[model samples]
Target: MEHSMFCYQCEQAMGGKGCTKYGVCGKSPEISNLQDLIIYQLKGIACYAKPLLEKGEHIDKEIVKFVENALFTTLTNVNFDLDFHLEMLKESQQVKETLRNKAPHGNYPEAATYNLSATKEEMIRDAVIAGVMYEVDLDPDIRSLRSTVLYGLKGISAYGHQARYIGHHSDQVDQFYFIALEAINNNNLTLEELIQMAMRAGDMSVEVMSVLDEANTTRYENPSPQKVNVNIKKGPFIIVSGHDLRDLELLLQQTEGKGINIYTHGEMLPAHGYPGLRKYKHLIGNFGSAWQNQQQEFDGIPGCILMTTNCLMKPRDTYKDRLYVTNVVGWDGIKKIELKEDNTKDFTEIIDKAIELGGFEKNEKEKEILVGFGHHETLSHADTIIKAVKDGKIRHFFVIGGCDGAKPGRNYFTEFAEKVPDDCVILTLACGKYRFNKLEFGTVAGLPRLLDIGQCNDAYSAVRIATALADAFETDVNSLPLTIVLSWYEQKAVADLLALLSLGIKGMYLGPTLPAFISPNVLQYLVDTFDIKPISTADDDLRNSLQQAN
Candidate 1:
């Protein structure tokens, strides 16, 4: 086989088709194939584990955790470490063997019985056959549904992994995961069955997101609306980025009074609103914009950088030495902070690096961004919101938030938010808000027009807010004056989209581009059934949405 690859698991897939030579996210062919092998090995493990789980047998905690993190590791821009991908593959096979040993004898498929004793070279070569293009005989629509469920499962794994760190567990979500993983290998399932499976995955994603929400609020009090400073303080400081709140908490505990300040970047901006985390005074504020601008914003920064989850770009040479990763996030030639024997990650290395770099010289800007308008906060204003609608003080509610990236045309989100009428309130979340978050949207119904509802996983909070509004108005969510315009990039957004559709909500304008994996038939199914749409201009979508609401 020629040394090549194909990956289309993201919104910016090359030409919106697939990446054949290398990933546009900076993943090399070697890393890509190794990730494929891990997925194949995981399928083998699931083949065995699902059956064992069915019989109510014991599966080790580590095995379950591995399955989740390995899926997360394969997400675009999350892990590009060649060695780490190989290591994950090795462990996945060990997990497969362990589960296989405990299984009752039965005729299992090749995925369940494949040998990993082949040389590394052979394993990489095998990935071409095992990767996304597998089951060449499968119907294109069926393939799209399968990819939908599979990719949504990746999102579930990401949230599930983070929730566990805060000591939350959900057997139902885990069971669904095992079933979905095993089912994806079955090519005989029809499109209807796959659609049902996809819906179930969406429902399961809700449960998983709920688990994470509970875990976060349980560990750190539910967020309240507060302003997060974006300017840097003069001192030895570290910029912690990505989506892992628990990791941020642990780092906060370790760095107390160490003469080092901590500033959040990207999705971590919401951390400053959590009561438990915000209590730390040295945990200063956010440092920059969304994940996509890191290469430029992070270039040659004096402070050390710690990435806890996804949204990693290929590092520029100037900042590589100052960068460190924790959890499942990985990149080649970068340092990592690993767990000790007691399962606690000592962030001493990054802390020391921040000290050595001498941190920021002074405050760069006086700007502060608002965050923490979670379900708890938004619901607190429920009576006011309902009254505003009744008095005709509020018109429509526009939900324009999701994952953000460096793709062209993402400016649509920024443009749409700007054009939202003053009578309507806007709800936003995730890193996507960086597009217009800095712009003042003023007030609606005595509340901030732009409500920063929290992180990507906090879509559950947005759902809660919407559902509560519908209940107050004596209608369902679809009947409420809500228009969802989303900007999606990767798998977390995939799960969020599924979760919304599972609730029977419709008319979500999605852009800057549609998923490459969704076949024409599957896309039509969504359009016909859910009234889903690809976004046009902000002016057109806004006009259409308002007209529909009337």
Candidate 2:
């Protein structure tokens, strides 16, 4: 078979092979090549930057921001314009060149030495050779480890971006980004060494998530239990999507008293929990479930759409014109909202559009969606949860969270959630919860049975909650009655999964399908070491989990 590009860093790679013609997330071959070139240049930048970081020399903060944005640009469905990626690649190349010149004495790899061409034709030519799989190691195991580290880096970069976005920056996290990218190119590293490095990436990710958690809570407020209204109101409204609370906050501030309501969508559902955000009465409620359901949920919506991050599908023409993208998210024809000098975006345009659209005449139905069951909120009820567990009222706990996708197999999560015994508590976050968030799970011990922690970045909260539970029980996390059933669609999920594994949390069930990046050898290593299982039938897996817990 012939192929134009090779990209397997997502769940829906073609036939478990690399994306040959185009990415399942609508990335074309040109964009794929540009993504590869961008990463290649990032590695170059790291090769030079790592040495400076190691020597305690101060690197520019802008470089760190660039690294974050460049990495985030490659996330699934985030950026699709060929010209835009080329510009990023060009900017990455210039930054890489400047860094390389600073450390001319540094023994940089071929990536650093390769000169980027100014013309588009020559750039594409260079990209073809810069692909991650260009020089495949003879050993599949070695290649697998390399891909694992690269994917993990992508996840790390994403969380790092979010952290930096909210006025939080970690030198350690920035240094690791450089070191990890530099190591990915080192040819002498053994398979064991590579595997260890991968775990370290996971370890760093846990730290990044923590930093992000603090950044979020400090910037906004600690998430608490709040019931989000899922139904839209009668007035003109704007639906803000993605996981960017900063953007949502700005939108809320700008739209206040403008007679336009603000509604959260997808991972933004947890925004209702932050007191700083929910204070505005016009910041009404959540409008939809996850990103995957946007097409149907957003169809005929009488408001504008703003994408602050990933999980944007090809906007259906029905709502495409009203869709506005900000930060790292971009589609060729979409209107882009840029931040002002003070780092706060003026959402005047979005607010104006919302008023012009003049949303639903009346809410079609009255419905409430409960979210914001994050760590503090849920742990506040820890005594009750523990008593329920001990008294046999709650039989088990399931941490079912990760990225959601559009594949049919994803129905497994919905079915699993529906069939989970009433005695079990379902802890979920990220977009994956959309599969079951709407379904009524009732209550357990006076608490909602399903807990929506926060975004994928809030995996740190889940870790904290689990560790606290284990400590309370005088046992380790694995010894507690908990199972992690994760649904993955993209690299952020990879980082979170690796973080879980790095924490020694074991026996996870990963679905709807395994990452296409995991080679058979790596898959075997994960199974043998962590007992990670690819999910089977929901019924079978539930039975097995319950039996194991007992």
Question: Which model scores highest in lDDT?
Answer: 1
Q: Per-residue error at 338 for model 1, in Å?
A: 0.5
**Tens-digit lDDT track for model 2 on 268-360?**
888899888888998888887778778898786788999988878878889987999999898889889998889988777877888888888
Overall local distance difference test of candidate 2: 0.85
Model 1 superposed RMSD (Cα): 1.2
Model 2 CA deviation exceeding 4 Å by range: 1-3, 104-106
TM-score of 1: 0.98
Task: Supply candidate 1's per-residue lDDT for 512.
Answer: 95
Among all windows of ten consecutive residues in candidate 2, which has the lowest summed lDDT? 100-109
Candidate topping TM-score: 1
The deviation in Å at residue 275 for candidate 1 is 0.5
lDDT of each: 0.88, 0.85
lDDT of 1 at 200: 93
Model 1 weakest 10-residue run by lDDT? 117-126
